[model samples]
Target: MVRLMRALREERRWIAAAGLLFLISAVLGYFNARSLDETLRAAGVWERLERAVSVIRADPTFLKAFTLIYWNNVKAVLTMMGLGIFLGVFPLMALVSNGTMLGVVLAKTAQKTGANPLWLLMTTILPHGILELPAAIVGAAYGMRLGMMAAWGVWGLVTGGHREVVRHWRRLLERIPIVVVGILLFLLAAAAVESILITIVAK
Candidate 1:
């Protein structure tokens, strides 16, 4: 736990950047909900999402829903972390896309139900999102750190600073397990809350 906290503290800047990107994209999605919806529909993503929700809703025990939510999140976070080596592009893209999707959902729900968007968010997303969002941000942050390291490593190789690059890479490798475990724990808790609370609230 202490190591996890330290690791997170060390990567705070990247996390903050990821969070800000998500916030900005979410605002954009909210304001441009109609266009975003159209785009998603065109890409078939909207249909797929609807089908996924329907499947979850059909599950009475919520076990299927929980498994789906948790595994999906785990896969996405792991993908972001793994692909972050390429200048952190994947994590950045994930932040923007996920944030936009969330905002669009909120906007659409508010429009459809004529409910206050904030109220809908509070009831639906906030409970689990409070934990899930932070976990995602942390994962993205670590990915960004890896991307930065990769960039620096390239520079180091070019400048004959092999020892420094190797040392940093080793340290990052050591911290990754701690970081990943922490993110997984957060995801697990979030999934449990979402599966129970959000499922009930939705129904």
Candidate 2:
């Protein structure tokens, strides 16, 4: 936990940016849920069923985005968006947006359930989020390194010195082990949460 906090502190800008994105997303989700609930209440059974079918049809897009979005959300929750450690501006923006999306989902779920937010969060979110989020962080962390190298490479191209680029890339290569470890832990936890805990709780 201390290390995690340290990691967050070290990557504060990225994490904060992600968190901001989460807040925006949460607000949107809350309204969307409310709108859906209202529709659910007003619709006849057939209409509601039709809406459900529409949702099913949309699931493909959801899944495609969900793969990336899920991990991004997970990263925000864990407060592990540390791309700024390597790259600066772009990474920070990405982190912030990622974090905001996470916050939005959480906030929306809480609002959707009111008093039962924890239960919903634990069951619905804790499942895939556990693995997906961490994997995102690992990816983000690596991206930070790549971004830094790319940025430096560009700078070197305009000005003239490959030293920084080589140095940053070398350090990034060393971080591969850390990313692997982080992703592995995240995936393992997510699998258990999704496959076991959520089912048991839902039952």
Candidate 3:
């Protein structure tokens, strides 16, 4: 636990930076949803309805991969930005993006329906959405932490100002796989929830 805390502290800056980016994305989503209020009201929201439905109907594999890639890319960006925190940002980004996606969906649903919209979500996404969203978000937060560690580790190597740099760098390298596997595990949890839970709820 102490080691983990140390790791987190060492990579705190990277995490903070990545968090800002993730929060920005969420804010963008909310703003877009609110802007579409007029458009949705004008179009009777039926048009947007099809597009929204298409999100599920379209090539699920492609959608999943695209989404996954989006998260991974952000993770990579943050990790690189981290300097030597030795964190893997891919997993972190995945989690954050998924959470954002779910938030967008939930927000839109509530806006259009003027209520909780929990029934629809329960039928269409629950069970799985619940599992998947949490897993992804947790994975993302952890991944972001790892990426920052990698960044700091690298920074330490170059500057060699701090005695703890080398030690932390090695820790970051060792932690990468742990973080990667952690993300994958969450992905699996999400998948199971989506597959079985979504279908059952729909029925």
RMSD of each: 1.7, 8.7, 7.6
How well is each residue in 1-203 modelled by candidate 2, as lDDT tens digits?
45544544554564454545544654564546555445434755337446644543455343433343435345543343344444545555555444544444565657656856567767776565656654664455545545566777888878877787777667656655555556556664664544353334334
- State TM-scores per candidate: 0.93, 0.50, 0.51
Number of the predicted model whose lDDT against the real structure is largest:
1
lDDT score, candidate 3, position 129: 49
**Candidate 2 RMSD to the correct structure:** 8.7
Show where candidate 1 strays beyond 4 Å: 198-203
How big is the positional error of residue 109 in model 3, measured in Å on the Cα after superposition? Answer: 0.9
The candidate with the higher TM-score, 1 or 2, is: 1
Whole-model lDDT per candidate = 0.89, 0.53, 0.53
Of the candidates numbered 1 and 3, which has the greater lDDT value? 1
Error of 3 at 9 (Å): 12
Among these predictions, the greatest TM-score belongs to: 1
Question: How far off is residue 155 in model 2, in Å?
Answer: 1.6
Candidate 1's TM-score reads: 0.93
